[model samples]
Target: MDDLDLPTAAPATIEEFRDRLTEITDGLPRRLRQCADHIAANIDRIAVSTVAELAAGADVPPSAVMRFCQILGYSGFSEMQKLFREAYAPGFPDYSTRLKNLKDGGAGSPSALLAEFIEAGRLSLEALAKSADETALAQAVSVLAGADMVHVIGLRRAFPVATYLAYVFEKMSVPAMLHDGVGKLDRRHALRAGDAVLAITFAPYSEETIALAQDARDRGLPVVALTDRPTSPL
Candidate 1:
């Protein structure tokens, strides 16, 4: 929003665009920061959304949206939109269309749905295997194994993973605690010296888990995070 110089060339890919956005969004003025946060969180909508629609979502004026685009090294909103369109507009079916097709093909049946879920899980595990860092993983295992206690915290979609981890640790005779945060309870005070943290989260990460993990790290505990991607804020 300031009258700072900006580059003319747009980011060539969505990943670059996102990295740039993450790098610059916090330094922007209030209105432009609003635009950046909205755009980052709703990137898939940009290809089809109008300037007015995006502005409303950001709770800023259309002029502010245009200025935000310029700040991101685009000529304007249209140029930014073109970038997203080029990235996501090629033969990608929307979820509604996919669901409709599944229903029509009787793929909504229980067995078919189970098979779909199994295949999806397999693909996710395969990707995880391909991307895992053995050295970092080994370091994490060493930290957990050496710790007096391991504090596990994950909520929402990540809760099951945390619970299973706790169960596994218990069965293996490891000292571990799972922070479920039931009834708005705060269990962060239980974190003690000689403890380590295992934080599990994905996109739209659990704030409670992050806060607790940060608390542990601030107290000099080693934190080994399990997240979806490198850019994830764990």
Candidate 2:
């Protein structure tokens, strides 16, 4: 049922590349490090720009870029470009471009809306499948399962997830509570030494979530953060 014969390779997907980049990029030589940082920040340009254009923007020689590609298991600049293109793919529009398109009627019909939703969900799943670390997940499960209680907090967009997790935890008889700011209550009062916390937020991280996370840490609770980026405040 599986491809038992597939050859092992370095960074098979954009998500894998990113995971490996975080762990290994810092130790790379100066030339490769520059190239890596440039591409990380300018992902939108990778799918459409030429090697020379990218190299110029990265301020490194084209050969150095090629060398970096080789380090990631690509055959050459073209091969590396193929991998680079995957992350911002299909149309490769920047966030502003996508926002503008939405405002300017990119999905003017039900069919267009459905297709857009499908594509977005598919990409999100693809990223999660490729990027989520199994060990981290296992560790989280161990901690939460062993905790006397789990304090789950998610504000605004993440509120639904928080509420649902709290429900499920209670159903599983894992003493837990959702910090929903009900009655203007200070949620930290609910935490105890044996309790743990799980906070969820995304970019432009919510101040409330950040404060809660900080408080949980200050109270010596095991805290887990669910957010969009590694640099998330939560």
Candidate 3:
């Protein structure tokens, strides 16, 4: 059969997915194992949902879902689902079976759970360390440090990060503004040339953040973005 016509198969039950998860993550860290469990439990729903919708259904952040996909040897959720659909050709594993395997697979000890958590964190940091661009990070920091006025914009969940950056910059004697909330018009009025705007946004990019960044750019401000994707609107 052609790739598209391959019968779309997923674990019929969460229990069967858990069993396969164990085999796939035999040597993985504890946190990742737990994340795998989360994915297994929700894979059926997630396979057919958008990233944002899947994250909400899984009760985890979108980044977590993306990270889980990466762990499963897929570039992202879309690719992961293609493999999942292909693998479960005849039929999907039963949900009850998958859950049973998860319940039965553990030692039920705090120490064991703790070990898994630590290992997961270790693996996550290692992966990030290997992938991060130090040069780009340095350039971003330099831009912030030397800016005449720093305008920070983050919408939705990213708003907290922008607020924290504004607070920290204040403490450091750097001129920064966190323009969020209803009073953004007043803040926007204050932007000027030679200023730098550090925008933090993610997919399903925030319209307000994009607007502000665009406005700043029109006024000759330098725009630097911190986003999940390199091609984000900001």
Candidate 4:
């Protein structure tokens, strides 16, 4: 909520923009906050979306959308769009095609794909090692180890990891329950006084996971969250 009298430098990268957004969004006025939320949630569409479309999605006027962009240090919407367009250049193959080819087992060699996946996993582990808090990790371990039961929940892309955790817990003779939201079931009722929650989610988090975690917190149950960043609402 500055005076908006001075021009600000634009963030150099999309990741930098996200870091800045996380830093400033909570302090913004309601309309601008809506713009931030909408943009963050639908980031992949930014290069193709118009000012009017973004405004409509945010339920704000076009002027507010422009102002939101300005607040993020863009001269206007075009400058912001330029950044995204450069990141998602038209020259590269789209993700869907690559995924389809992988599914068909026809485009890339298996060894190449295996190397790619292994490299990705290695990088992810390195990033986690750099950012993880040792004390917090120990606390989480203690909490889950002591809980009467651990309720695990993750959906969409996070579903596989959550299911794997639940499976491992069971094999180790540790009590665990997975809230898969099957048939849209409301499993928040399964949370109990002595239970803990292990919530795994990422950006644009699943609402059901957040709700269940919140419910567990409200009941004074311990909640260990595995999410993307500190700013995430897990």
Ranking by lDDT: 4, 1, 2, 3
Clashing residue pairs for model 2: none
Question: Per-residue lDDT tens digits of candidate 2, residues 9-45?
Answer: 6676766766655654666778777877777666556
Candidate 4 positional error at 223, Å: 1.2
Model 1 lDDT per residue over 1-234, tens place: 344458556687766787678777767788988888788767767888899999999999999999988877888889989987776554244343445666778565799888865655665455356435677789999999999999988899999999999999999999999988899899888888999999999778888889988888799989989876444677
lDDT tens readout by residue for model 4, 17-57: 77778877887888988888888776656777899999999
How many clashes does each candidate structure show, in the order listed? Answer: 0, 0, 15, 0
Clashing pairs in 1: none
Best model number under TM-score = 1
* Each model's lDDT: 0.81, 0.74, 0.66, 0.82
Models 1 onward score TM values of 0.64, 0.62, 0.50, 0.58
Please give, for residues 59-165, the per-residue lDDT of candidate 3 as tens digits.
66788767766654456777766654654432333343444554679737889767755655665455356436677789889888888899988979998999999
Tell how far residue 217 is off in model 2, in angstroms.
Answer: 1.6
RMSD of 1: 5.2
